[model samples]
Target: MTIRLASIEDHAALAGIFLSVRRSTFVWEDPASFQLDDFASATEGELIHVAETAENGIVGFISLWEPEQFVHHLFIANGHRGKGIGRALLDDLARRQPGPFRLKCVAGNSVALSFYKRSGWAQIGEGETDGRPYLLMELSKTDESTLSSPST
Candidate 1:
């Protein structure tokens, strides 16, 4: 798989992944609320990177709110989780922005929380969004080990 900046051509695939993942993963939310076009609205003005494979095409994407080094979203397609695609996308982002990056993971997403912990992100705080609780996570400036290399 290769990670690169998303193009206009990649938008449809990105939207699909975003919609499907949110619908499947966020059980606490009304799945019907996540629309394909939600991806474009949510990620507007952010820097986006996509993971693509020769066979599977676009499998995942990560978007960053650059000014604050905030990670706005990271979603992998339904069949593509736990395959290092998320980490690869993050590493690619670090290589590009060299961030002390931050993101908010829904409190109910234990799977995602585990992934973030394994990736050297820590729970720096807590907050609520859209009436749902979330854990504020951060990868500190010193936590660069996972950002070291690109995975295949």
Candidate 2:
């Protein structure tokens, strides 16, 4: 898979990938909440990266709000998970920023919680948003060693 900056032409495809992955993963939520227009509007001006395949076009994407040092979104298409695309996108971001990174995972989403923990992210806090419980996680640049270490 090839990872690169997302272009204007990639917006629609990225939106589709975002919607599909989110709908499947967050099955407990209403799918209508993941709207394409809202995604397009919210992601505007963010540092968005896309993971693509020569044959499949764009398969996954990661969007970061550099100013806030937060990851606003990271989604890999349903059929494309477990292929290292998520890690590749994250590693690319880590290399670019080399600083503290933060993201939130829904409380019941064990898959996401596990991935973040395994990637060296520590749960820093917990709270509820939109009536759903979530965990706030962070990974520091000084903790790079844990990035490559096995998940405890």
Candidate 3:
């Protein structure tokens, strides 16, 4: 799979990927509530990177709002999970912003929670969004050295 910055031409594909992944993963949310136009508007003016395969087109994407130091969105297309695409996208983000990174995972989404935990993110707190509970996670730059140090 190739990971690269998204271009204007990629908007429609990216929006579709986001819709599919979000619908499948966040089943608790009303799927009908997620509109393609909303996804496009939400992703506008952000730093987005897409993962594409020659055979499958755009399979995943990660978006970051640099000004806010937040990961606005990260989604992998249906049937495209567990293949390291998420990690590759995140690795790209870390390379670009080697500072504190933060994101929220819906509390009941165990798959996402586990992935984030395994990816070196620590849960700092909890909150609710649209009435759904979420865990606030962060990967601090300082934590990197701590994570690499030999445990004594």
TM-score of each: 0.93, 0.89, 0.88
Evaluated against the true structure, the overall lDDT of model 1 is: 0.88
lDDT of 3 by residue, 10-59 (tens): 99998888777777777898888888777778877789989888899989
Ranking by lDDT: 1, 2, 3
lDDT of 1 at 104: 96
Best by lDDT: 1
- Residues 1-152 of candidate 1 have per-residue lDDT tens digits of 98888999999989989999999988888999888899889999999988999999999999999899999999999998988899888877776786689999999899999998998899999999888999999987544564657755
Record all residue pairs in model 1 with backbone atoms less than 3 Å apart, i.e. clashing: none
lDDT of each: 0.88, 0.82, 0.82
lDDT value for model 2: 0.82
RMSD for each model, in Å, please? 1.6, 3.7, 4.8
Q: Rank the candidates by TM-score, best first.
A: 1, 2, 3
Q: Which ten residues in a row have the lowest lDDT in candidate 1?
A: 142-151
Positional deviation of residue 34's Cα in model 3 after best superposition, in angstroms: 1.6
TM-score of 3: 0.88
Q: Which has the higher lDDT value, candidate number 1 or candidate number 2? A: 1
